[model samples]
Target: MHKKVLNRDRASFFVITLPALLLYSFFYIYSVVLGFYYSMTDWDGLSRKFNFVWLENYGKILKNKAFFNSVTVTFRYAILMVVFTIVIGVLLAVALNSVKRFKTFFKSVFFFPAMISSVAVALIWDQVFIRALPNLAPLFGVANIASPLGNKQLALYAVLFVNLWQSLAMPTVIFIAGMQSIPDELYESAVIDGASMFDQFRFVTLPYLVPTITVNAILTLKGGITSFDYAKALTGGGPARSTMLIGIKIYIDAFGDTPKFSIANTESVLLFLVIALLSIVQLTISSRSGVNKA
Candidate 1:
């Protein structure tokens, strides 16, 4: 009787999960596995017959200067986005936590951008960078400051700034949520002990907020590195590929012409490895920090 009951439970579990599992396997896992196989073969994405090119595609990526530049751009965007988002988000969260009036209004105002479509956000920022800035330069006191997007020297940073502006709100909300979750007594106890505001923040607030910070940092880093829409819609990785992230480069390589499937697959593999390694490192660091804090 017990054996029959156990079998029934197992069957029920499988029946309930089967559809979602099938979808996941077909769409995600299957594609990933097929991609790895295709990475070894030099096939135009549609071709039925193509030569297997072993490690040549991977070698080309390793030797490609453009690939290195893309990697650099990815890291640059990720670092800037993570730093600015965390700093600004934490500051705003702290300020908002202390506010008494129009708190929800202010929170919604800051978070409004996050609710907008990324492509829409990118297009709006593109216009501001390409058209509005040029027209408004005189009002800002420097008529010589051209659209930063047009200048190769400033284009990538310009994209980074716009990305930061759109993204900071989510982190701010997360930080605020994390802050609110902290026990009120901790702050009260610190105040009673005559701890200065900064001291209380450093000792009491920061240690507790570290987990949220870790999660946000990892998310920002991954999103930055894999960023496609903003770079695509804003600059199209223009001014001699100055703003080209790895994601864009991979797209260009894959479908820009007769699809270089093997090369693109190699790039995809490399991109996945880079992101996976960084995520692992971040998790390790977060774990260590949590342990130390405890």
Candidate 2:
């Protein structure tokens, strides 16, 4: 009877998961395999014939100045986004957790930006930066209110600012949960011992938050590295192509000017490796640090 029950349970689990497994194989797994295959070929996404050049395309990417520039821009954007989002999210979470008034209202207000569609957000901000800002500049005694997206020096920072604004919701949620999970006894004990709020946060809160921080950091970094929709809709890689992310570069290579499918696939593969590497490193550090204690 026990053996029969175990067999039936295994069969039920497989039945429940089979559809999802099949979909994963058909979509992500298959697409990743195709990307690798094309990256080695000289396929321009057209023509009847092309030869595989193994790693020649990968080597060319190293020598490509535009590719290098895109990488630099992505790093700048991701670093700033991760830093600002984590700081802002943590502050909001802590403040909300400590207060009893209008908590839900503030939470909803912060998270609402994250819920908006990226393209729609881009369009809304484009108007604010390009049209409204210039018009308002005169009233503020400003002579020239140039569009942020049109300035080569400031275009990357503009994208970073907007993206940071949109990406704070998840981290804020995670942080509140992390803070709340600490036993009330710990905080009470610290208070009785005459420890100030800053001391408690430094010694207790931050240590408990390490895992949450790691999770938010890794996810936000990946989002910044592969950002595309906003770049396409807002800057269109303009102002001397200053704000082009790796994902946008991949799109341009595959669809604009010269359509080189293989080159785009190569860029995609590189982006995948970067995200994967960071995830592994973060998980490793998190595990070594232990989730519960400092």
- Candidate 2 positional error at 53, Å: 1.8
- lDDT on C-alpha atoms for all candidate structures: 0.87, 0.87
**Can you tell me which runs of candidate 1 are displaced by over 4 Å?**
1-7, 291-294
**How much is the lDDT of residue 113 in candidate 1?**
89
Off by over 4 Å in 2: 290-294
Q: Please give the lDDT score for candidate 2.
A: 0.87
Error of 2 at 267 (Å): 1.1
lDDT of 1 by residue, 1-294 (tens): 999999999999999999999999999999988888888888878688999888878887899999999999888888988888888889999999889999999888888888888889888988877677777768888756577887888988888888877888888889999999898999899999999999988988898889999999999999998998888888899878889988899898889867787788888888888899999999997977842464
Per-residue lDDT, model 1, residue 105, is: 93
